[model samples]
Target: MEKSPDAFRTISEAAEELDVPQHVLRFWETRFSQIKPMKRAGGRRYYRPADVELLKGIRSLLYREGYTIRGVQKILKEDGASYVAGVGRGEIEPRKREGEMASAPPPGMSKPAPRVKGAKGEAAPAAEAPAQPLLPLGEVRVVVNRLSENHADMLRAALRDLGDARRILDPSQGR
Candidate 1:
């Protein structure tokens, strides 16, 4: 028989609904301190509705959004489990972590000033930060994948440039 919407689910049921293995669910319990499943005799676990939602959020963050376990932990700490649950429920969208913008302006380009209401109720421009672009989940994955691939090349080029500069500065040291 199908269960009620508010019914507690077993570890296997929860794992199946989340499309993850039961062991993965068990592992998540260890990593996320916020996941507190009710334990009965024989140490059987029963996941409440809220717990399932939190797991879905964590799954989305790790697998779909490509966030590290530590990153997800920071989100749980800063934003709370309820916020994560909201993300799982599709009521809230996940945002990029600080310093991890997907659509940052190119270097040498300044961000636009923010618009504000003046004392006379006129729209005035104020110094506000640029808004972040809301990219689709698929596009975000592509961008992140490209960045990881290019990051090493960028670092290698930087190191080569630094070495060449050092050689030019100290000819004797090059020997």
Candidate 2:
């Protein structure tokens, strides 16, 4: 069944509804600075309907329209509501209201200066390289198993010791 829009969501629920990872939502909370969800005990997050709507808008801007984190910040600074509207439509173009610069490029287009190798060297591209594809879960599990074997072994040893101590302390247990 479809959940109502007024439903309050945990961080995981909000992330799933917005089609983003919970870590991404956590990161967004740090970057956007405007996304402030109420926190229950034990650091659990509860998002209101407005918070969910804002997350949806931010997700559209970052994933669909390809806005950088900084670009979204700039858009929010200029016109907060308009930015949300643009994101809802999956468009990153800045609105040119009266008296604003009409010929300016969108916020995402503004890039940092290219890095030069040396005084006489040509400037290299400042943009980061395209990300590589992530490894599959099976491969990741194998890697994790290899990496965590020592920790897992220690935990197993500790559990065995606890079991031995329990048997020794129990008078009814067979010697």
Best by lDDT: 1
- What's the true lDDT of residue 40 in model 2? 91
Which regions of candidate 2 deviate over 4 angstroms? 89-175
Estimate the Cα RMSD of every predicted model relative to the unseen true structure: 17.1, 22.1
Q: What is the lDDT of candidate 2?
A: 0.67
The lDDT values for all models are 0.79, 0.67
RMSD of 2: 22.1
In candidate 1, residue 62 scores what lDDT? Answer: 80
Number of the top candidate by TM-score? 1
Candidate 1's error at 4, in angstroms? Answer: 0.4
